[model samples]
Target: MNWGPPRTAHVTMTFDPEGLTRTQREGDACVACHKKWPRPRTRIGRLPDGTALFACPECADALLPQQDDTRSRPQRVAFF
Candidate 1:
């Protein structure tokens, strides 16, 4: 199966022991988009520490950090 360009949403995925065991016994799991894209086999991406990022290329791109951090700021207290 091949996944050319990712086209799904970004989602954080924790490694499941059963899933790992299954893949070890067999091989990489077939992604739903495999039939859509016939190249670049769209598999999961892992972080340096082995965290899995289960999302398509497009979704991944959208997940990139944005310039704005104001929305995450704590409420300001008014001083007398």
Candidate 2:
């Protein structure tokens, strides 16, 4: 994987063994690694079984980039 610049949190954050936990309410385990911690609203997606994917910044950073087609190169579209 070429891997481009990071666009998410936890790329630099050291992994907390227990990870971060939800402060608002109960939540599902992280979809990528099943770690029970996600930012207040980082909704990943739904599983084939229809389960919601909630992930911490670390898991998000790790999984999201691999899914991104553009790795080393800069993105072409400007969001701002």
Candidate 3:
């Protein structure tokens, strides 16, 4: 089986500005959950005109696959 990383170009994804709210477009709210407090800092993608997209850590994890948790950690082996 292929346990390889997800193939989605999540960070470089291009979003449609028309679908986003004014706060999201202005970087004031999360692009995923639309949360305003503790402003989302993780860059997920950009709009057609080059506007950066942001999402909360929780939402970001759901939207994109995590690399560090799966690839960097060594797998444990069982002994009989």
Candidate 4:
């Protein structure tokens, strides 16, 4: 009998801005990881101008940007 590779599960994630409690920037290390999401929540940071970024825990992992995926650039070819 052979043990196969572990199967990964697909999870649905949701984000609610109002649900997040205001947490100090220094208190969470996960703030840096949340920057990869398309929509990250803004919180007060230690500095006046700085901010603490946040996203739903589940969304954080799922929403992260994939490596080496290049976006299409518009071609600029002059037509005579």
Candidate 5:
């Protein structure tokens, strides 16, 4: 079994001023649920194509093959 991290590249996501919450960012969408949220909940993960994966909490769960609950969400993640 390959219980390891995926190899991907760095990418960036920028939210508009209004995209700060779940009731402000218009037209925001969740890639997993395919539903529109005022602001999409996202976590930074790696994609197969060497890019960052922007996904909702639920999607993040499915993205990872293994389930690891030990690591809680970071208070503030700054990706540069």
Candidate 6:
């Protein structure tokens, strides 16, 4: 099979599970704020055992670094 890059890649760094609770470690709660009412679906990072850590959309944005906007800049000119 010649499939391209993975549909969803987790580039976030792995977090230490030292002080995390069972629910957070199990992905049932947001790893950042620990909100349980709405199940966190954004995969923020992973644990030592490869357990995917999740967080709410807001938390995810806060955790992840802001993307640079390069499209709006004018093209650069090179001089000989």
Pairwise lDDT winner, candidates 1 and 6: 6
List model 4 lDDT by residue over 2-79, tens digit each: 352222112322333343434424334334453443444332222333343444455444554434538888989899
Best candidate per TM-score, number? Answer: 6
Candidate 3 — which residues are off by over 4 angstroms? 1-10, 68-80
Candidate 2: pairs in clash: 4-71
Per-residue lDDT tens digits for candidate 3, residues 25-72, read 988899989999998887788898988778887887887766654557
Please tell me which predicted candidate would have the highest lDDT against the true structure. Answer: 6
Q: Tens digit of lDDT per residue, candidate 1, span 1-80? A: 53444442234333344344333222233222222232222334544455443433543355433344466767788995
- Rank all candidate structures by their TM-score, best first, as comma-separated numbers: 6, 3, 2, 5, 1, 4
CA lDDT of each prediction against the hidden true structure: 0.38, 0.45, 0.79, 0.39, 0.44, 0.80
Of 2 and 5, the candidate ahead on lDDT is: 2
Query: How close to the true structure is residue 49 of candidate 4, measured as C-alpha lDDT?
Result: 36
What TM-score, computed on C-alpha atoms, does each candidate reach? 0.24, 0.36, 0.69, 0.23, 0.32, 0.72
- Give candidate 2's whole-model lDDT: 0.45
Runs with alpha carbons beyond 4 Å of true place in candidate 1: 1-5, 22-27, 30-80
lDDT of 6 at 27: 92
Error of 3 at 17 (Å): 1.1
Q: Show the colliding residue pairs in model 5.
A: none
Tens digit of per-residue lDDT, candidate 5, span 1-80: 64433422133344343223342232255545645554445544433443333455566456545545697887876885
Lowest lDDT sum, 10 consecutive residues, model 2, at 8-17
Measured on C-alpha atoms, candidate 6 has an lDDT of 0.80
76: Cα error in model 5, Å:
25
